[model samples]
Target: MDLTGPQLCYNYTSNVIGPGELKTFKCPASIEGRFVRITKHTVASTALRLCEVIVEVNADTCTILDLALNKSATQSTTYDDGKDHAGDAWRSVDGNLDPNMPVGQSCSHTDQVGHQWWQVDLVRYYHITQVSIQNRDVVPHRLGNVSVEVSETNNFDIHSEFYDAKLCHYYEASDVPASTLLILPCSDNIVGRYIRISKFVPILYDVLSFCEVIVEGGDPSCIQGTTGITATTTVTENTTDEQTDTTDSPEITSTTISLPSTCPCSCRGSIEKYYNRSIESLLDELREELMVSKKETASYTRTLVSVDDGRTSSRNIGYVGIVLLVAVGLSIVVPDVVSLAMYMKGK
Candidate 1:
């Protein structure tokens, strides 16, 4: 069996399988497909058989989401055995895992050929994680070296081939087993809208078959939204303190003052002139106080000099009075002496 859309999706092949044995195949990447087919190569002769076919989906993690339920499916060819049909691929994905019906009702198949394929279209892009395929219980060994691939473009031109698709997973003869589901995980995180399953090598037969294909992943664009904040600035010419708006704007608490027009040319010059005039007036007051203090000091010195001269004159008058008293006593004593001499001579 082969899976394809505009590009090749997958290819299935194997050596051989025992009778009444079942198997599975898985894809590593989530594959979106619009078509699925089963056929044979021009040089090989082998028929395709399938008990059922399944497709699943997943998101961010490894959890599986049933995205293929009731989705559209198609095949390249159907078996002439009047029992199986191409729509059986959809019934296999309808939550039915066991094949207890008749042999024709149990699976889907195609005529013997080497270039047969099957495909499906997911209609959108998803972050795919894993794909699983279940084999039919009748003849599962036909799916041996199967390759599964995915792509977004639908360029299935015969001349160009399906060159736009990328390989998601591939299995060899040793990798296929009997009576078990095959699981493939996408290690490289492959993303696409179309999934294709195809068989490249012919083993027991050139047939490609599967019971189901499941895809799982999350939406690539289901992210949360965020809000952002913006800031604004305003500029104005010839603005004053009174005209400036402080609400919803930065505050200006203080400002510089200019000199009044009635004053000097500049505020600094006016201030300097006022300071010089005040200093001169203070200096004149100090000079007047100093002159009055000097006049008082000179008057005090002259009074002290006049009082010393008066004391010297009073001391000289006292010496002259003592000399006069001594002269009067001497004159009285001389008269007494002359009288006494005269008395003696007369005796």
Candidate 2:
């Protein structure tokens, strides 16, 4: 498994692909990024586990936007232009320009909720792929329709355009696969001047909800190609003078093993821990067997000692006489030591 893209997402092979084996789905990689909050989302029906949900983004390069109050691009007012927004009623779908957004004017919005959006140069962060949003809006906002627009004109703002999302590209539950990973690719490491992420309805209906937008800089799900295979060659000596014994010669045995299928999304980690624990248990069993052998050897040694003590034969009596002689020698040494000390003291 390559840990290059994401530690979690990887190519998974099913071992039982032959017959009526059940199919399995792999989890997506984690993305870390900035967020906007939505308060509503319903309980998911899929049994798949999301190991961890994080949006990844390079902050020094991302541009944000909020249209509630911020504006972008302003220049010398030209009311004489036939496209003046003040001259006609602006519809939600009509590309209208506010007086505040001229050709050179730029603004920023720090929402009371701290949703800071970039008002000027919205194109700085345009491309997006794989959008995972959590509708913190409490209940599904009945946002059956949403519009995503891309414009180069700096005259319009995104806030006045939320309901105006008619011309923009957006997706719905019917259009998007439910309870599955949403794939978006336009969010790559791209550079642009304007990007507008507008939705028709906030996914949250009653309460405010948090929605996560994920833009992939690179193929976060790309798996590295399997490396080349390398096999070591064993050199065989034709003959050897010390070959009198070949009883412990090494042997090569090959066994086929099937890969195990674990939920990478649900459980994050290596299966080696399980394998190591098993090997430890086997080693412990072997140790127990060795302990049993040591006990048997000790029991045999005790039997031999007992048999020697009970023997009345010549060998046994010879040992007994040698022990008695040792005792007499010790007795003689004790008296000599006392006499030597007494003579030295002239007692």
- Candidate 1 — worst ten consecutive residues by lDDT sum? 222-231
Provide the global lDDT of candidate 1 against the true structure.
Answer: 0.55
Best by lDDT: 1
Clashes of 2: 50
| Candidate 2 local lDDT, 1-347, one digit each (tens) | 33344233334443323221223333444443234222223375534322234332343222221211122322111122333322111111122111122221211111122111211233333333233322222224322233333333445445443222112235545233222323333422222233344333323221111222222322212213311222333434344666645565543232222223322111224533443233346566779876756545878878866774544696778989999999999999999999999999995
- C-alpha lDDT (0 to 100) for residue 181 of candidate 2: 27
Give model 2's TM-score versus the native structure: 0.23
Report the poorest 10 consecutive residues by lDDT, candidate 2: 87-96
Task: Report how far residue 79 has shifted in candidate 1, in Å.
Answer: 2.0
Candidates' C-alpha lDDT: 0.55, 0.33
TM-score of each: 0.42, 0.23
Point out where model 2 deviates above 4 Å. Answer: 1-131, 157-159, 162-168, 174-194, 200-209, 217-347
Candidate 1: tens digits of C-alpha lDDT, residues 75-181? 45544555444434454344444433254343444455655555666777655566666666656665667777776666776732356677778876633555456
